[model samples]
Target: MTAASIVDPMFISGASVWPLVEGGKGVAASNGTSAGAWAAAGGVGTISGVNADLIDDNGEYVPLIYKGRDRKARHEELVEYSTKGAISQARIAHELRQGEGRIHLNVLWEMGGCERVLTGVLEGAKGLIHGVTCGAGMPYRLAEICARHEVHYYPIISSARAFRALWKRTYHKFGDWLGAVVYEDPWRAGGHNGLSNAESPDQPENPFPRVLELRKMMREMGLDQIPIVMAGGVWHLKEWMNWIGNKELGPIAFQFGTRPLLTQESPIPQAWKERLLGVAPGEVALHQFSPTGFYSSAVRNSFLNELYERSERQVAYSDDPSDADGRTVFLPYGRSNHGVYLTPADHARATAWMVEGFTQPMRTPDGTLIFVAPDRARQIRRDQADCMGCLSHCRFSAWKDRDNYATGHQPDPRSFCIQKTLQDIAHGRGDPIDNQLMFSGHNAYRFGQDPFYKGGFIPTVKQLVQRILTGE
Candidate 1:
């Protein structure tokens, strides 16, 4: 019952592993290099988000060679890209397999052709990948899919209740092959957070009791021995040692998200790494403005700053004519200029941008757009037409097929295309301020309190894992 009595399990599902898990990040943050480094340290590492097919010929990312007439004829081109990427990642893991650490892949549940993409990676990566982690929606069939492929499966969840639902309906029979469960703090994690609108964004519950409850639920279902990986805002291990060896908590583990981002091998832009160094505690915020409709954490980059400012000045409206309705009205861009309410400063900024011909066009769910730039607009249109149908209802495609119902609302300008921003950031876009949508944990400010990290030195995966494991 005591925190000191918690037990940190060495491995999950009979696989050799460390107590730490290198949390999977999307858009190339957690690549083969970072994952390989973590696996080399005897911990589990996950590479995720459309695993880059960028290969090295002589220690450099090389372009694949393909000949095609049209897009369909380019099938071989895309397949070659995917194969090269999967192979590079597998080779990296193989190089570090001697440490007896486990290697895994985390795939987003909503990504297009999830089954084919995962199967491709697994088939290409046969012996190297030990497990698969999935989240961002209930992966009801993931257990069966991974089971068929003979790989362990971990479903990332925020609450014990959600796990119970999944177990009863899907994973309960899988038993030993179920691997470990990852409990990511919905309010404090980077990337797509799992919190719903009903939950209080400002108040986060202490994870210790929540995790214990998860253990108890697992016990009731005859799954008590499974490890629970704690993720989100986990930095110092010494502070968490108090939870080690606790009986009520059962087998425990920790997954680090933002902390891993500062590692030298992490494939993020240098400017982004430097930004995290200067972040103060409470500087990172959990906001619910993502196009995916999920809450995510990030430092106040220029993109986020503009979003926050616009939201703060946002006024609500109702159809009632009475002023007593307490509803304010807003005008659609390029519509009647009157009755449009905006803060004086915001109005001025919008007016200036418009006057300078920097117009904001409607955006699609996939982030494609018809902008003023003719060439760029053409590209956006092409990209939109080439939709992989990644999301259930892509706002970009204006694709809606639910009972033939339609919102008829155009794409939102308030939100930028996630694919574009994340891609740019991952590929080393120099403008950290303008282009990238950086994600971080709420505890990012603590970096300033630690004297050893003064002015920020990018630590390698080995250094971070060692620090956490040794309770430093």
Candidate 2:
């Protein structure tokens, strides 16, 4: 169960991936330096989560800059930014690679212009990128798209069944070109998760059988040689050695998401790293994101606390005449108007808090209004106008689609703009308890259980690779 026992050879498209990969994180958590460090170590490193054009002086990611008056014009700006970001990321990968490792790009399928943005980046960085990894949705055309560009592709899936669904539809045609398959644990991963309502968030199933089934499916589809990269909640080699030499699983590799957040080369704020040190097992929870309609994981901080409170207080509306309406409601402080609704003692307490300026107003993505703050509310509206229209039918947009379809009841107050929050966090304006929406694996609490990670040592990419490889 030591690191030496876990080290194994992993191959993708004739390239060797030292049995370890640094999973791609969004908003610049896994950037060139982090990915390069992994590549430098003879493993695969994925640069992801809206990569910045770090080549610009001042270390500021240039693509995030807003310009243009309309969505079309703004989208052009985004293309330019993404191109530069891709080049910058590729250059960093090449520099750190020393010509001995594999480097890949990770893109979320749900992101605005997913295919276009990724294509622009990949086209710009021709020889620099070895592969492309995508998750969050079933990328039905991924194999076709990558094949057209002659690039390798890896789809992140949670179960063997999902992979089978994809293979039957698209990847089956690409055959050997499909580089690797990533299985990220739904119950335990940072960022947007892949769980459905049918799956229980609290329960985690053994990954061994799931991986074996996926390998079997791949074999049946004539892809037995493709490696399976395990992601989410993977911290140490000793915990994973049991899967290394299993015959049913075949060639297996591991991908680390949250563990990489504490690396010196990682671009996360220092305070974020410090917070991970104090995390206990079960401290991380999987909840539905009001923004993207997907499950995501993160430490339960003030931001989450506020969201949870809102959910608890949410009341279902009924059109039946028996239902109470127009009841005396106390509005939160800074709300332009009070006396919205009140039925119970808790409603009275809410009204009291509002009168005392103890509460803020927030709007959901569905256009339902809840009081958050006058200042915060104003900021949300102002930030919404700057929207490059990154998402299709943004809930913030009171603007409708071209078909006169009322982008129906848009302008949700419950969800804040993801771009704004992520941008703020990336720029170091993040507060672990308030501003930043931190994402981690469900197993993040396991850090407290281990002695080696006591006090949350932020290791360098080199140190992480060495430790995982050596099993120290």
Candidate 3:
């Protein structure tokens, strides 16, 4: 390794490029324009293959509109739409890179019709996408798909055990196509996190030990030269000097998720970019509100506050009016007056919330009731009704993509429709930066503190890459 290892280029995905990687953000955040510019800057650029956008004749993004009449039909339409968009984005990225750097596609394993979309994109955009990085589920078929397409596969995992399990179960058969293992620190990363049941979201563990463990396990598996991309909470390369030349870990790389959001090539709206500049410490939160049932990090705003408040205003319930404790009170259910019983103390709390205008009590799959304002309840119902089946199984709408097209449970009022909000925010519909779901890394406050972004100045992708290479 060179003394100036931070600026040294490392080979990745059949190309010699900087170890810096752009982690893909979905719903039009990191698109072809941004990914291509990063690739042009001589780094691995990842395009969000999840719900990519298409351009119209005027060189503007075409609004995603569904023509299907029902959830299942709409899901099929979504799959077809995503394939075309992915192909278009891949071509654009390939053109912009000019064959200088590799362009990787990022897709979620649990996204609706993952297999069909991957098949269509890889077949439709042959030789354009060099690799595919997948997370959010086991994705046992990812290696097989990438192998068939003649592309590399990178699996994003939180721990060494997860990677070991994946390799033993299926990836071992396609080891030749294994690109690298992305060790994304679940507590600090933006978007959907990979935190397991044993990990506490409040107590973030040191990523150094985790990455070291992963590298140790990889070496034992005869994968010493395979690069490990350290993601999440990584701000400056200078702060990570020890990891570069350490003998314990070989061929290390870095991935940036939130730092690139302020670049000119980023596809997110101007309002969203501006919002990042003013973010303060503790403004971003790691919460579990996604319909996919994964812990995600997002900026704290009215949108997130509403969800937090709903969970706070919740109480357990029972069907029997007379409980064994003999201190039960009943709350009517949508004119049925069904004996939904609650303890006396809980009843008092619910009555107080009702008097405060939280009259609507919605039942969740967990057998708990969340009290929300009537307007909010109606909006939730409306959003649930407009489900497009973007996820394989959504708790918000209880719409499953396969089988009977339902999760065999009622729509969860505790969750919100992620598809609608992500699309709306990306389209800048009504400038919903604060009103819609906004994902960000926990280190977002660095944008406000870093002198590099002083005076609300936004840099181009190339300039940002150069700045990062300087270890700042």
lDDT of 2: 0.72
Report the error of model 1 at residue 98, Å: 3.2
Cα error, residue 90 of model 2, in Å, equals 0.9
- Model 2 worst lDDT run, 10 consecutive residues: 314-323
- lDDT string for model 1 (65-149, tens) is 4466543334335445655675676667667556567888888775544566677787877877888998887888888888888
Q: Give per-residue CA lDDT, model 2, range 1-472, as digits (tens).
A: 3345457666764586587888888867788888988898878888883645456756555546666887656756765676578678877887887987788888877666677778788778888888889998888888888888788999999998899899889888886678889999887778888886778877878877888888988888877777899988787777776787877888888888877777789878777777777787777878874366678888788777776755554432212222245434444333354323444555665555457553664545432335554676676677666666555445655433235423566565555567667766766774434556778887677666767576666677877787778654
Candidate 2 vs candidate 3: the lDDT winner is: 3
Candidate 2 residue runs with Cα over 4 Å from true position: 1-5, 49-51, 57-63, 317-369, 393-409, 430-434, 446-449, 454-456
lDDT of 3: 0.90
Of the two candidates 1 and 2, the one with more favorable TM-score, higher being better, is 2
| TM-score result, candidate 1 | 0.80
Best by TM-score: 3
Off by over 4 Å in 3: 1-5, 56-58, 325-327
TM-score of each: 0.80, 0.87, 0.97
Q: Write the per-residue lDDT of candidate 3 for residues 1-472, one digit (tens) a residue.
A: 4554465787788888899999999878888888999999999999898988976445666666888878888898889889888888888898899887889999998888888898899999899999999999888999999999999999999999999999999999999999999999999999999999999999999999999999999988889998999999989999999898788888888999999999999988889999999999999999999999999999999999999999999998888866675537887767665648899899899999999999999999998899999999999999898898889889899988788999999899999999888988887885357989999999999999999999998999999988888889
Q: Estimate the Cα RMSD of every predicted model relative to the unseen true structure.
A: 5.7, 3.8, 1.4
What's the ranking of the predictions by TM-score, best on top?
3, 2, 1
